[model samples]
Target: MSGDVVVPAHNGVRRGRPPQTPEQADEVRARIELATAAVFTEHGSRGLSVARIIERAGISRPTFYRYFGNAEQPLHSLLTLSNEGLVGGIRDALARSFEPVQLGIAIIDAYLEWARGHGPMLRPVFAELHDPASPVSGYREEAFDDIRALVRAKFTELGRPLPSPLDLDTALQTCEYVVYRVSAAAHPGSEPDPADVTEARLTMIRSVLVTLGNRADVERALTVPGIFDERV
Candidate 1:
């Protein structure tokens, strides 16, 4: 009785009470994808079940099946979202930056902002990145390739020298590590400490500057008036 999903259908069948339009279907699918991400992040893949997903999404089994074959179906979408969203954010940030220091900050801000929005979705992605059998096991490398291309182009545009390939690879990894570390420390659904955020951003900025040039570049970027804490 109470567990049954009652829908007043107009034209669609009981098992296919479809949305009025494709956009509505997309909205519903997004909700399920996010709920699946939350489930996976908190409970891992083994705990992923259609029941839990339906409960989290406040939808009937049929409704979920309408958009996804099963609970795990949304995981593929989430993987796409996790990787593409981060790369997309970074690419968009490139347009707003005009110089070396600004580029560093813009990219860092993009990453942290993405991390904040996808806080609950990062854990499952970490698992996927290391799993050899995952269909999208190459997702991380692909996303990195996209990011490196964007960074290389941005650097050339600003007349900045690109680091050796080895250096650039590690440098990009370092920035990602910084974001993951700081984001994990900050609780989702609450404001993080301003001081901690500044510290992490400055760390990313300094790491990039050091990689692009040397101590002189690092000092110059950090010394930009009012751009950083005076004590930093």
Candidate 2:
């Protein structure tokens, strides 16, 4: 009868009324995240409130507070989820390509596709991380580390050297900046039309290729019709 007192473990298992299976707990967590994203997309972080999130998520106040201490916690969760999705997509894309140039193009396309799909949810999270005064800024380093690891893994797999004139870390950091710019532009409020988004994605891909000393690959990638188009 005291569902309100249910406590969740690190793995998301909750000890409470009727006892939820791990899968159920995961579903609950995912539901909360999806609802958080939808609400955040509709109302910027500045306007976000616990009440609204709980309402949108269709969960009790106790449930919301049990999973997240505050609005920022869910935002952090969203950021983590976004990174997981991006990394997973990149891994899958890499698995499908044997050619180094094709792998590079796939990575770029994977990133842009993920951003385009999740930009609404990601914009405010990124905005907070970019703000020096925001407590969420601490997450910036974590994000950078995740991205760097992904880049390192890709280079290792391809057995290709990183571009000269810049160390791997520096090159990845620069690439992160390019991703940030593209993600910002793709944010729901500022998203360009489809044609413009395609152009921007291609531009980012070309820039990435050049930075990685793969300019020749860019021309090859462009020769494919709708090469930049989001894959189903």
Candidate 3:
């Protein structure tokens, strides 16, 4: 045995097992995202820094970088997640075959609930999307597509042929934007009662859908089975 006998190296061993797969990496990403959202709420998304996020997440800088290239990546991912939740609700409301009026009401109610639940996330979305400087910044095409598919399904249910005309696109754009605006108004400082705002929103949406075509068909469609069964 030489005086410089080698000792087995245990230098890089982690205290616990590491996450093994991409799914685990995604899970870590999700945890970092949630922690980032909490931190953002306390210190606005724009104010969030990589060090602050890493500190809040209780993760090393390397761990943070593994999931998010920088602070903005997590913030953007969070916004996408938030938007996806809102889009899911829109899809649900559309699935329920309510009258044009009922559909509008359902959409408004669903959206309002989402805004109430995710108030912090909405602020950044609004700021980014509403800013003239940020073209294509806030709008998620995938999210809007989820909503459009739902509307298309309702149209199909009412035996309406899909129009190649831009009319349908215009109508959907109006309806979605109305909900977005109403939700922003309900965001805390607005004078309007959320309930009343929702009602007013639905009324406006109904008017638009009716103007496009088939108001009565919307009503009849709502009366059909599974629309309001509540069991769903």
Q: Model 1 segments beyond 4 Å from truth?
A: 1-19, 123-128, 133-137, 187-191, 214-216, 226-232
Task: Mark the regions of model 3 whose C-alpha exceeds 4 Å error after superposition.
Answer: 1-6, 9-31, 38-48, 98-101, 130-139, 163-196, 211-232
Worst lDDT run of 10 residues, candidate 2, spans 163-172
Total clashing pairs in model 2: 0
lDDT of 3 by residue, 1-232 (tens): 6588655547856456665698888777878897888777665656778898888878899988877788878877776766777788877777784555566557656766666676555555555554554322545555666766776777788677764337656665665566557656653534446676646555555545555557575666456553333442
TM of each candidate vs. truth: 0.77, 0.66, 0.63
Give the candidate order by descending lDDT: 1, 2, 3
TM-score of model 3 (CA atoms)? 0.63
CA lDDT of each candidate?
0.76, 0.68, 0.65
Against the true structure, candidate 2 reaches a TM-score of: 0.66
**What's model 3's lDDT at 188?**
56
lDDT of 2: 0.68
Among the numbered candidates, top lDDT falls to 1
Tens-place lDDT per residue, model 2, 1-232, is 6457755776896546776789988888888887878877776666678888888889999888777888767867876667677677777887787775676577778876776676555566556656775544655566556656666666777787744435544544554566566566653566646765566666655556556646567667667676545667
- Candidate 1: count of backbone clashes, pairs at least 3 residues apart or interchain: 0
